[model samples]
Target: MNVYMKEQEIKTKLSAWVAGQSSGYHADSVPFDLRIIEQRIITSVQIMELILFLEHLRGEPINPMQIKPGAFSTINSIYQHFFIEGQAYA
Candidate 1:
């Protein structure tokens, strides 16, 4: 896994993407624990866009079989499941 990207950098990019998904948010102000999907901060269709963003960030394709809805529930969970070592419970 060439997941050598710094965690902060990854989170920054992720935050920017999520913030851009909404009109009233900013990258730095995006709450890590916010239930974006559940709150409709990001639309259902945007979920696929999020996945694609993550894939581009991680430089790899996420295994569809290993994905769970909980992994996409929030910014923090998404980072934990995809970028962090060992925390990727998939």
Candidate 2:
């Protein structure tokens, strides 16, 4: 897939996962730029789960050093970090 399509696919998966975190939210309701961590849409305990999910999407293990603060802060950030920057799945 091309970059935009891949990015969109990643966003959709991320949105679906994030939306599953709580009630009153749907995949379409989760904004790409939403602050998932600060807003507590994803709690601290679930952050690890999110990372694992991301790794699953990438089809490989993520490097520990690549993880940084705010990397999982939003769907956009996560996509940029793992898909664009990491380029592992691509």
Candidate 3:
């Protein structure tokens, strides 16, 4: 079967994950600013948690060397790195 995952779906999942972080803001409350970096809201612990979450979600180990500051900068940045770049499965 051909499964198509929409960008909004991906964004929703990512937004939900971000909400689980210590950002102190609801997922829906945050503006959909793709340019917002993780450093602005996410804590170090949250970033680690996000890494584990992404690894599990992608069903593969994310190489540490491949991770960049820009990778986890924003929801859209993460989406682009994992989904658009074909590094992760839906």
Candidate 4:
């Protein structure tokens, strides 16, 4: 695997995570229009779970600053934070 995941890969993994976290969603697929804020998937209980998921995916400690208001707004947003701007492990 590449040290850093491409945009689409990150999005796919994030979608999978979202699906796993939600009861009615499918783990293998996500809708193109899905948005975290609109879907309200990020409940207070999910914050730590999300952090741990990102850390595991990136193989590094995720910074607290990256967990901002719009960080988990969408799969694309999470990709940008973890892989693009934040720079996943190595």
Every model's TM-score: 0.80, 0.88, 0.72, 0.75
Candidate 4's TM-score:
0.75
Clashing pairs in 2: none
lDDT tens digits, residue span 27-48, model 4: 6677635786677776757867
Off by over 4 Å in 4: 1-5, 88-90
Q: Number of the top candidate by TM-score?
A: 2
Where model 2 places Cα greater than 4 Å from the true spot, the runs are 87-90
The 10-residue segment with the lowest total lDDT in model 1 = 81-90
- Estimate, for each residue in 1-90, the C-alpha lDDT of model 2 and write its tens digit: 987898898899999999998787987889999998888889988887887898899888886565767788899998888887876433
* Cα RMSD, each candidate: 3.7, 2.3, 3.4, 3.3
**Ranking 2 against 3 by lDDT, winner:** 2
- Ranked candidates, highest TM-score first: 2, 1, 4, 3
Ranking by lDDT: 2, 1, 4, 3
lDDT of 3 by residue, 1-90 (tens): 223457776677778777766457677654446444534577666777877787777777777567755777788788778767746333
Off by over 4 Å in 3: 1-5, 34-39, 86-90
